[model samples]
Target: MEAKENTTPTPTTTTTNQPELFTASDVARFCQVDLKTIHNWADKGEIRHFRTPGRHLRFRRLDVLDFLRKYGYPIPEVLRLGKPKVVAVDDDPVVLASLRKALSKRFELTTFQDPFDALVAVGSIQPDAMIFDVRMPGLDGVKCLERLRSIDTTSHIRCIVYSDAEEMKKNATEAGAYDFIKKGEAAELRDSLERLMGLERE
Candidate 1:
Protein backbone atom coordinates (compact mmCIF):
# COMPACT_ATOMS: atom_id res chain seq x y z
CA MET A 1 0.00 0.00 0.00
CA GLU A 2 1.26 3.44 -0.92
CA ALA A 3 1.27 6.25 1.62
CA LYS A 4 -1.02 9.16 0.79
CA GLU A 5 0.81 12.15 -0.71
CA ASN A 6 0.87 15.17 1.60
CA THR A 7 0.21 18.38 -0.30
CA THR A 8 -0.46 20.82 2.48
CA PRO A 9 0.74 24.27 1.40
CA THR A 10 3.36 26.21 3.28
CA PRO A 11 2.04 28.81 5.70
CA THR A 12 1.56 32.18 4.01
CA THR A 13 2.28 35.58 5.56
CA THR A 14 -0.89 37.28 4.37
CA THR A 15 -2.77 39.20 7.03
CA THR A 16 -6.08 40.99 6.55
CA ASN A 17 -8.64 42.78 8.70
CA GLN A 18 -11.44 41.99 6.30
CA PRO A 19 -12.94 38.53 6.01
CA GLU A 20 -10.83 36.19 3.88
CA LEU A 21 -12.41 33.89 1.33
CA PHE A 22 -11.09 30.61 -0.05
CA THR A 23 -12.13 28.85 -3.19
CA ALA A 24 -12.94 25.16 -3.32
CA SER A 25 -9.54 24.43 -4.79
CA ASP A 26 -7.89 26.19 -1.88
CA VAL A 27 -9.92 24.16 0.60
CA ALA A 28 -9.03 20.99 -1.25
CA ARG A 29 -5.35 21.89 -1.08
CA PHE A 30 -5.59 22.72 2.60
CA CYS A 31 -7.40 19.47 3.43
CA GLN A 32 -5.18 17.41 1.12
CA VAL A 33 -8.29 16.05 -0.58
CA ASP A 34 -9.61 16.10 -4.11
CA LEU A 35 -11.17 19.32 -5.41
CA LYS A 36 -14.42 17.45 -6.02
CA THR A 37 -14.55 16.50 -2.34
CA ILE A 38 -14.62 20.15 -1.38
CA HIS A 39 -17.41 20.83 -3.82
CA ASN A 40 -19.33 17.86 -2.43
CA TRP A 41 -18.83 19.19 1.10
CA ALA A 42 -20.29 22.51 0.04
CA ASP A 43 -23.13 20.85 -1.78
CA LYS A 44 -23.90 18.64 1.22
CA GLY A 45 -23.78 21.66 3.55
CA GLU A 46 -21.00 19.99 5.56
CA ILE A 47 -18.93 23.17 5.27
CA ARG A 48 -20.38 26.65 5.63
CA HIS A 49 -19.92 28.52 2.35
CA PHE A 50 -21.37 31.04 -0.02
CA ARG A 51 -21.38 31.68 -3.73
CA THR A 52 -19.78 34.70 -5.37
CA PRO A 53 -21.71 36.83 -7.84
CA GLY A 54 -20.30 34.62 -10.54
CA ARG A 55 -21.55 31.60 -8.58
CA HIS A 56 -18.06 30.54 -7.57
CA LEU A 57 -18.06 28.70 -4.24
CA ARG A 58 -16.31 30.66 -1.46
CA PHE A 59 -15.62 29.78 2.15
CA ARG A 60 -15.01 32.44 4.77
CA ARG A 61 -11.95 32.17 6.98
CA LEU A 62 -13.99 31.73 10.15
CA ASP A 63 -16.13 29.07 8.50
CA VAL A 64 -13.03 27.25 7.37
CA LEU A 65 -11.57 27.48 10.86
CA ASP A 66 -14.76 26.03 12.33
CA PHE A 67 -14.66 23.15 9.88
CA LEU A 68 -11.01 22.45 10.58
CA ARG A 69 -11.54 22.58 14.34
CA LYS A 70 -14.57 20.33 14.16
CA TYR A 71 -12.69 17.71 12.16
CA GLY A 72 -9.46 17.88 14.24
CA TYR A 73 -7.30 19.28 11.46
CA PRO A 74 -4.11 21.15 12.28
CA ILE A 75 -5.01 24.80 11.86
CA PRO A 76 -2.79 26.59 9.38
CA GLU A 77 -1.24 29.81 10.64
CA VAL A 78 -2.64 31.98 7.86
CA LEU A 79 -6.20 31.20 8.93
CA ARG A 80 -5.41 32.34 12.46
CA LEU A 81 -4.97 35.96 11.35
CA GLY A 82 -2.46 36.41 14.20
CA LYS A 83 -5.24 36.44 16.78
CA PRO A 84 -4.22 35.59 20.32
CA LYS A 85 -5.93 32.38 21.42
CA VAL A 86 -7.56 32.28 24.87
CA VAL A 87 -9.16 29.48 26.87
CA ALA A 88 -11.60 30.18 29.70
CA VAL A 89 -12.70 27.69 32.35
CA ASP A 90 -15.93 28.54 34.11
CA ASP A 91 -18.66 26.39 35.60
CA ASP A 92 -21.46 28.88 35.09
CA PRO A 93 -23.08 28.83 31.67
CA VAL A 94 -24.07 32.48 32.01
CA VAL A 95 -20.51 33.49 32.82
CA LEU A 96 -19.19 31.51 29.85
CA ALA A 97 -21.75 33.17 27.57
CA SER A 98 -20.82 36.61 28.85
CA LEU A 99 -17.11 35.91 28.42
CA ARG A 100 -17.75 34.73 24.89
CA LYS A 101 -19.73 37.86 24.08
CA ALA A 102 -16.98 40.08 25.45
CA LEU A 103 -13.81 38.35 24.23
CA SER A 104 -14.69 36.37 21.12
CA LYS A 105 -14.33 39.36 18.80
CA ARG A 106 -10.87 40.27 20.06
CA PHE A 107 -9.39 36.81 20.60
CA GLU A 108 -9.75 33.22 19.58
CA LEU A 109 -11.75 32.20 22.67
CA THR A 110 -12.45 28.60 23.76
CA THR A 111 -14.44 27.89 26.90
CA PHE A 112 -14.90 24.82 29.08
CA GLN A 113 -17.46 24.33 31.80
CA ASP A 114 -15.25 21.77 33.48
CA PRO A 115 -11.85 22.86 34.74
CA PHE A 116 -10.58 19.28 34.42
CA ASP A 117 -11.52 19.22 30.77
CA ALA A 118 -9.85 22.58 30.28
CA LEU A 119 -6.72 21.27 31.93
CA VAL A 120 -6.66 18.27 29.58
CA ALA A 121 -7.34 20.39 26.50
CA VAL A 122 -4.93 23.22 27.34
CA GLY A 123 -1.89 21.20 26.31
CA SER A 124 -3.31 20.77 22.82
CA ILE A 125 -4.98 24.21 22.64
CA GLN A 126 -1.75 25.89 23.72
CA PRO A 127 -3.58 29.17 24.15
CA ASP A 128 -1.57 32.28 24.84
CA ALA A 129 -3.65 32.98 27.95
CA MET A 130 -6.33 31.38 30.12
CA ILE A 131 -9.13 32.63 32.36
CA PHE A 132 -10.16 30.50 35.30
CA ASP A 133 -13.13 31.01 37.60
CA VAL A 134 -11.90 30.76 41.17
CA ARG A 135 -14.89 28.81 42.44
CA MET A 136 -15.76 25.66 40.54
CA PRO A 137 -17.41 22.43 41.69
CA GLY A 138 -14.83 19.70 41.04
CA LEU A 139 -11.55 21.55 40.43
CA ASP A 140 -11.25 25.12 41.69
CA GLY A 141 -9.40 27.74 39.68
CA VAL A 142 -6.37 28.01 42.01
CA LYS A 143 -5.66 24.28 41.84
CA CYS A 144 -6.08 24.42 38.08
CA LEU A 145 -3.56 27.23 37.83
CA GLU A 146 -1.19 25.40 40.10
CA ARG A 147 -1.46 22.25 38.03
CA LEU A 148 -0.72 24.16 34.85
CA ARG A 149 2.31 25.81 36.46
CA SER A 150 3.64 22.42 37.53
CA ILE A 151 3.40 21.08 33.98
CA ASP A 152 6.27 22.00 31.67
CA THR A 153 4.09 22.36 28.59
CA THR A 154 1.48 24.60 30.26
CA SER A 155 3.60 26.50 32.78
CA HIS A 156 4.42 29.25 30.28
CA ILE A 157 0.76 30.02 29.58
CA ARG A 158 -0.43 33.21 31.25
CA CYS A 159 -3.41 32.55 33.54
CA ILE A 160 -5.87 35.00 35.07
CA VAL A 161 -8.23 34.26 37.91
CA TYR A 162 -11.83 35.45 37.62
CA SER A 163 -13.96 35.46 40.74
CA ASP A 164 -15.87 37.71 43.11
CA ALA A 165 -13.83 36.69 46.14
CA GLU A 166 -11.03 39.18 46.63
CA GLU A 167 -9.48 37.05 49.32
CA MET A 168 -8.35 34.52 46.74
CA LYS A 169 -6.10 37.10 45.06
CA LYS A 170 -3.01 36.39 47.18
CA ASN A 171 -3.49 32.65 46.88
CA ALA A 172 -4.03 32.88 43.15
CA THR A 173 -0.94 35.04 42.80
CA GLU A 174 1.10 32.60 44.82
CA ALA A 175 -0.27 29.80 42.70
CA GLY A 176 1.20 31.52 39.62
CA ALA A 177 -1.80 33.36 38.27
CA TYR A 178 -0.59 36.11 35.97
CA ASP A 179 -3.47 38.36 37.03
CA PHE A 180 -6.77 38.35 38.89
CA ILE A 181 -10.05 39.97 37.92
CA LYS A 182 -13.38 40.21 39.67
CA LYS A 183 -16.34 38.67 37.93
CA GLY A 184 -18.51 41.05 35.83
CA GLU A 185 -15.54 43.26 34.96
CA ALA A 186 -15.52 42.41 31.29
CA ALA A 187 -13.75 45.60 30.23
CA GLU A 188 -10.97 45.12 32.76
CA LEU A 189 -10.61 41.46 31.81
CA ARG A 190 -10.38 42.32 28.14
CA ASP A 191 -7.80 45.01 28.77
CA SER A 192 -5.75 42.75 31.01
CA LEU A 193 -5.88 39.91 28.48
CA GLU A 194 -4.90 42.23 25.62
CA ARG A 195 -1.94 43.49 27.58
CA LEU A 196 -0.91 39.98 28.60
CA MET A 197 -1.14 38.77 25.01
CA GLY A 198 0.68 41.86 23.67
CA LEU A 199 -2.27 42.75 21.49
CA GLU A 200 -3.08 46.40 20.81
CA ARG A 201 -6.72 47.42 21.09
CA GLU A 202 -8.43 47.93 17.78
Candidate 2:
Protein backbone atom coordinates (compact mmCIF):
# COMPACT_ATOMS: atom_id res chain seq x y z
CA MET A 1 0.00 0.00 0.00
CA GLU A 2 1.39 3.30 -1.02
CA ALA A 3 0.81 6.01 1.59
CA LYS A 4 -0.30 9.32 0.16
CA GLU A 5 1.93 12.25 1.14
CA ASN A 6 -0.03 14.94 2.97
CA THR A 7 0.30 18.52 1.76
CA THR A 8 -0.13 21.39 4.19
CA PRO A 9 -1.53 24.71 2.99
CA THR A 10 -0.35 28.04 4.34
CA PRO A 11 -3.05 30.15 5.97
CA THR A 12 -3.63 33.58 4.46
CA THR A 13 -3.73 36.58 6.78
CA THR A 14 -4.80 40.19 6.28
CA THR A 15 -3.46 43.09 8.29
CA THR A 16 -5.36 46.32 8.74
CA ASN A 17 -3.58 49.58 9.51
CA GLN A 18 -5.54 51.79 11.86
CA PRO A 19 -6.23 55.38 10.96
CA GLU A 20 -4.77 58.38 12.78
CA LEU A 21 -6.28 59.07 16.17
CA PHE A 22 -7.66 62.35 17.52
CA THR A 23 -8.07 63.60 21.05
CA ALA A 24 -11.34 64.26 22.86
CA SER A 25 -11.14 67.98 22.09
CA ASP A 26 -10.55 67.30 18.42
CA VAL A 27 -13.67 65.15 18.22
CA ALA A 28 -15.70 67.67 20.21
CA ARG A 29 -14.70 70.54 17.92
CA PHE A 30 -15.54 68.56 14.80
CA CYS A 31 -18.84 67.32 16.18
CA GLN A 32 -19.70 70.68 17.80
CA VAL A 33 -20.14 68.99 21.14
CA ASP A 34 -18.51 69.25 24.57
CA LEU A 35 -15.59 67.04 25.55
CA LYS A 36 -17.92 65.35 28.03
CA THR A 37 -20.17 64.38 25.16
CA ILE A 38 -17.22 62.79 23.38
CA HIS A 39 -16.41 60.81 26.51
CA ASN A 40 -20.03 59.73 26.81
CA TRP A 41 -20.17 58.62 23.19
CA ALA A 42 -17.01 56.58 23.66
CA ASP A 43 -18.33 55.12 26.89
CA LYS A 44 -21.62 54.08 25.31
CA GLY A 45 -19.88 52.71 22.19
CA GLU A 46 -21.80 55.20 20.09
CA ILE A 47 -18.54 56.18 18.44
CA ARG A 48 -15.55 53.99 17.70
CA HIS A 49 -12.60 54.68 19.99
CA PHE A 50 -9.19 53.47 21.07
CA ARG A 51 -8.34 53.33 24.74
CA THR A 52 -4.82 54.03 25.90
CA PRO A 53 -3.01 52.16 28.68
CA GLY A 54 -3.97 54.96 31.04
CA ARG A 55 -7.60 54.69 29.88
CA HIS A 56 -7.56 57.85 27.78
CA LEU A 57 -9.86 57.68 24.79
CA ARG A 58 -8.85 58.51 21.25
CA PHE A 59 -11.10 58.71 18.18
CA ARG A 60 -10.23 57.89 14.62
CA ARG A 61 -9.48 61.22 12.95
CA LEU A 62 -10.99 60.30 9.59
CA ASP A 63 -14.05 58.85 11.25
CA VAL A 64 -14.57 62.01 13.31
CA LEU A 65 -14.19 64.28 10.30
CA ASP A 66 -16.60 62.14 8.34
CA PHE A 67 -19.04 62.24 11.22
CA LEU A 68 -18.81 66.03 11.24
CA ARG A 69 -19.48 66.25 7.53
CA LYS A 70 -22.40 63.89 7.84
CA TYR A 71 -23.92 66.15 10.47
CA GLY A 72 -23.19 69.31 8.46
CA TYR A 73 -20.67 70.65 10.95
CA PRO A 74 -18.14 72.81 9.17
CA ILE A 75 -14.49 71.67 9.21
CA PRO A 76 -11.89 74.40 9.23
CA GLU A 77 -9.45 74.39 6.34
CA VAL A 78 -6.52 74.75 8.75
CA LEU A 79 -7.66 71.76 10.77
CA ARG A 80 -7.79 69.74 7.58
CA LEU A 81 -4.25 70.91 6.93
CA GLY A 82 -3.18 69.64 10.41
CA LYS A 83 -2.10 72.96 11.90
CA PRO A 84 -3.97 74.77 14.63
CA LYS A 85 -4.56 78.53 14.50
CA VAL A 86 -3.74 80.31 17.77
CA VAL A 87 -4.37 83.90 18.87
CA ALA A 88 -2.08 85.45 21.48
CA VAL A 89 -2.74 88.75 23.26
CA ASP A 90 -0.02 90.61 25.13
CA ASP A 91 0.46 94.31 25.80
CA ASP A 92 4.23 93.94 25.86
CA PRO A 93 6.20 93.95 22.66
CA VAL A 94 8.91 91.77 24.18
CA VAL A 95 6.41 89.18 25.32
CA LEU A 96 4.73 89.14 21.92
CA ALA A 97 8.09 88.70 20.26
CA SER A 98 8.97 85.84 22.56
CA LEU A 99 5.63 84.14 22.04
CA ARG A 100 5.92 84.47 18.29
CA LYS A 101 9.27 82.79 18.42
CA ALA A 102 8.19 80.11 20.87
CA LEU A 103 4.92 79.01 19.31
CA SER A 104 5.29 79.75 15.61
CA LYS A 105 6.43 76.26 14.72
CA ARG A 106 3.48 74.47 16.28
CA PHE A 107 0.69 76.95 15.63
CA GLU A 108 -0.40 79.75 13.35
CA LEU A 109 -0.09 82.68 15.76
CA THR A 110 -2.02 85.93 15.41
CA THR A 111 -0.82 88.30 18.13
CA PHE A 112 -2.30 91.54 19.47
CA GLN A 113 -0.90 93.84 22.15
CA ASP A 114 -4.29 95.34 22.71
CA PRO A 115 -6.92 93.19 24.37
CA PHE A 116 -9.70 94.95 22.45
CA ASP A 117 -8.05 94.13 19.16
CA ALA A 118 -7.65 90.54 20.27
CA LEU A 119 -11.37 90.33 21.02
CA VAL A 120 -12.11 91.62 17.53
CA ALA A 121 -9.60 89.25 15.94
CA VAL A 122 -11.17 86.20 17.58
CA GLY A 123 -14.25 86.43 15.37
CA SER A 124 -12.21 86.48 12.19
CA ILE A 125 -9.39 84.15 13.23
CA GLN A 126 -11.60 81.45 14.79
CA PRO A 127 -8.54 80.17 16.57
CA ASP A 128 -8.12 76.80 18.25
CA ALA A 129 -6.55 78.43 21.32
CA MET A 130 -5.70 81.82 22.84
CA ILE A 131 -3.18 83.16 25.35
CA PHE A 132 -3.94 86.43 27.11
CA ASP A 133 -1.79 88.65 29.34
CA VAL A 134 -3.65 88.89 32.62
CA ARG A 135 -2.48 92.43 33.28
CA MET A 136 -3.25 94.12 29.99
CA PRO A 137 -3.61 97.89 30.46
CA GLY A 138 -7.26 98.38 29.60
CA LEU A 139 -9.21 95.15 29.21
CA ASP A 140 -7.64 92.58 31.57
CA GLY A 141 -7.34 88.89 30.78
CA VAL A 142 -10.29 87.85 32.93
CA LYS A 143 -12.51 90.43 31.24
CA CYS A 144 -11.27 89.31 27.87
CA LEU A 145 -12.02 85.71 28.76
CA GLU A 146 -15.54 86.64 29.85
CA ARG A 147 -16.17 88.62 26.68
CA LEU A 148 -14.99 85.75 24.56
CA ARG A 149 -17.23 83.34 26.44
CA SER A 150 -20.22 85.56 25.66
CA ILE A 151 -19.61 85.45 21.93
CA ASP A 152 -21.06 82.51 20.02
CA THR A 153 -18.13 82.13 17.65
CA THR A 154 -15.36 82.46 20.23
CA SER A 155 -17.09 80.83 23.18
CA HIS A 156 -15.53 77.45 22.68
CA ILE A 157 -11.97 78.61 22.04
CA ARG A 158 -9.61 77.42 24.76
CA CYS A 159 -7.93 80.31 26.64
CA ILE A 160 -4.81 80.49 28.82
CA VAL A 161 -4.14 83.30 31.25
CA TYR A 162 -0.54 84.47 31.34
CA SER A 163 0.18 86.31 34.56
CA ASP A 164 2.92 86.92 37.08
CA ALA A 165 0.47 87.43 39.89
CA GLU A 166 -0.44 84.20 41.63
CA GLU A 167 -3.61 85.79 43.04
CA MET A 168 -5.19 86.16 39.60
CA LYS A 169 -5.14 82.46 38.78
CA LYS A 170 -8.42 81.79 40.50
CA ASN A 171 -10.05 84.77 38.82
CA ALA A 172 -8.93 83.59 35.43
CA THR A 173 -10.28 80.09 36.11
CA GLU A 174 -13.56 81.57 37.29
CA ALA A 175 -13.74 83.67 34.14
CA GLY A 176 -13.57 80.56 31.95
CA ALA A 177 -9.85 80.42 31.31
CA TYR A 178 -8.88 76.89 30.34
CA ASP A 179 -5.46 77.20 31.98
CA PHE A 180 -3.16 79.66 33.73
CA ILE A 181 0.59 80.18 33.70
CA LYS A 182 3.06 82.62 35.21
CA LYS A 183 4.57 85.06 32.74
CA GLY A 184 7.95 83.85 31.38
CA GLU A 185 7.27 80.30 32.53
CA ALA A 186 7.96 78.70 29.20
CA ALA A 187 7.68 75.11 30.39
CA GLU A 188 4.32 75.70 32.06
CA LEU A 189 3.02 77.47 28.98
CA ARG A 190 4.24 74.63 26.81
CA ASP A 191 2.51 72.06 28.97
CA SER A 192 -0.74 74.01 28.93
CA LEU A 193 -0.61 74.47 25.18
CA GLU A 194 0.08 70.78 24.68
CA ARG A 195 -2.82 69.83 26.91
CA LEU A 196 -5.15 72.24 25.15
CA MET A 197 -3.98 71.22 21.66
CA GLY A 198 -4.26 67.54 22.55
CA LEU A 199 -0.56 66.88 22.07
CA GLU A 200 1.06 64.24 24.22
CA ARG A 201 2.91 65.73 27.18
CA GLU A 202 6.67 65.37 27.41
Which predicted model would earn the best TM-score? 2
- TM-scores of the candidates are 0.60, 0.61
What C-alpha lDDT, on a 0 to 100 scale, does residue 118 get in candidate 1? 71
lDDT of 2 at 9: 19
What is the lDDT, from 0 to 100, of the residue 175 in candidate 1? 93
- TM-score of candidate 1 to 2 decimals: 0.60
In candidate 2, where is summed lDDT lowest over 10 consecutive residues?
1-10
Which pairs of residues collide in candidate 2?
none
The residue-level lDDT of candidate 2 at 77 comes to: 44
Q: What is the lDDT of residue 58 in candidate 2?
A: 76
For model 1, the stretches where C-alpha displacement exceeds 4 angstroms are 1-81
| Candidate 2 lDDT by residue in tens digits, 60-153 | 5434554565667776543344445567777787887777777766556677766776666566656667888778687766777898788765
What is the Å distance of residue 92 in model 2 from its true position?
0.6
